[model samples]
Target: MRRRKLSPEERDLWSRVAATTQAIHPVRPAPPDDLPAPQSTPKQKPPPPKPDLRDFRIGQSAPGFVLRQDLAPPLSERLAAGPVRMDRKAHQKMTRGRLEPEGRIDLHGMTLAQAHPELIRFILNAQSAGKRLVLVITGKGKRGLDEGPIPQRQGALRHQVPHWLHLPPLAAAVLQVTPAHQKHGGSGAYYVYMRRNR
Candidate 1:
């Protein structure tokens, strides 16, 4: 259907009527009393104050202490009378050949490439020779490949010895392991105790 456009006078009159309606109906706000009151939150309790003490003594000596006298040999004498039993198996393993001068072998300056095959042969030969204790110096891999490309993640043999000991030929011969003495190579070496091949 065709619609006819409003003339200029009619358009002007419609716009004035719309403006009058908007001015009269400007949004009426809610009364102030209808809005929420400010909340009154309770105050939190403060932490308790630190205690004050005039006299507090730790490790205080007791007055008039009577000592019980020993009727047997002194503690040191008693301990020395019997062989000292090591509580740790590892300590015992490390000292298995403490009295034997020829029981240990140091492999400190050798690399994994050199030591791996030699270690297998060494264990078999030592076992065959009836040697129970052997010292291996894998050195603490702390100084591993510092200046080379593809730097070693482990301290050379420091970390590799234990894993190598667990391999087929070596694992079959080894009975126990423990950290070596400072004179023997300290943390860089280990005392590998082997079981006698029957």
Candidate 2:
């Protein structure tokens, strides 16, 4: 088939149309300068401070603490005298029987090596006896006392008691264990709560 070619005038007309289209569609300029810039609002103030915990006092109603003594038979049977020497005011505060728990136990005279087995037995026996809590006292070891001039190889019973509490037999019987309060035996004692025996 034969084709027809555009004359010069026709070509010139097409070019003019393309140029006119581009000019009409010139890129829109950024929004007019009359619009204001965005300003952020100020931050709100924080709420007032909470009460200081240091100012709070432990109430007489705080749970009673016990000292576990390791003394043998007759000596072990008696409850250890309260280690804390309370002032007259403090003593009066305890007159209401507010600081006593259900029971107490003492482990003071026994070494860890000896006491470990007794501790296991006590937990089991305490559970069977329907006792919920017991106290175990492990004295702050022979720190200043005479021993080899250099620190001896002897272990600290105070530190060893906690380790025994974490052992399998004792841990299984114990539901929870915590350090005794000051009026009890303080850091030298622990309060052991036993799981109910099935």
Per lDDT, the best of the predicted structures is 1
Mind sharing the TM-score for model 1?
Answer: 0.48
* 1-198 per-residue lDDT for model 1 (tens digits): 999999999999999998776465668675599788668999999999988955647887534433343355532243235443334554553454343323555567787798888778877888898887777777665542344334435466666776787678787887766666667766777777677779
| C-alpha lDDT values of all predictions | 0.65, 0.61
Residue 171's lDDT in candidate 1: 76
Score every model by TM-score.
Answer: 0.48, 0.43
Candidate 2: stretches off by over 4 Å: 1-103, 144-155
User: What 10-residue stretch in candidate 2 is worst by lDDT?
Assistant: 73-82
Model 2 per-residue lDDT at 35: 88
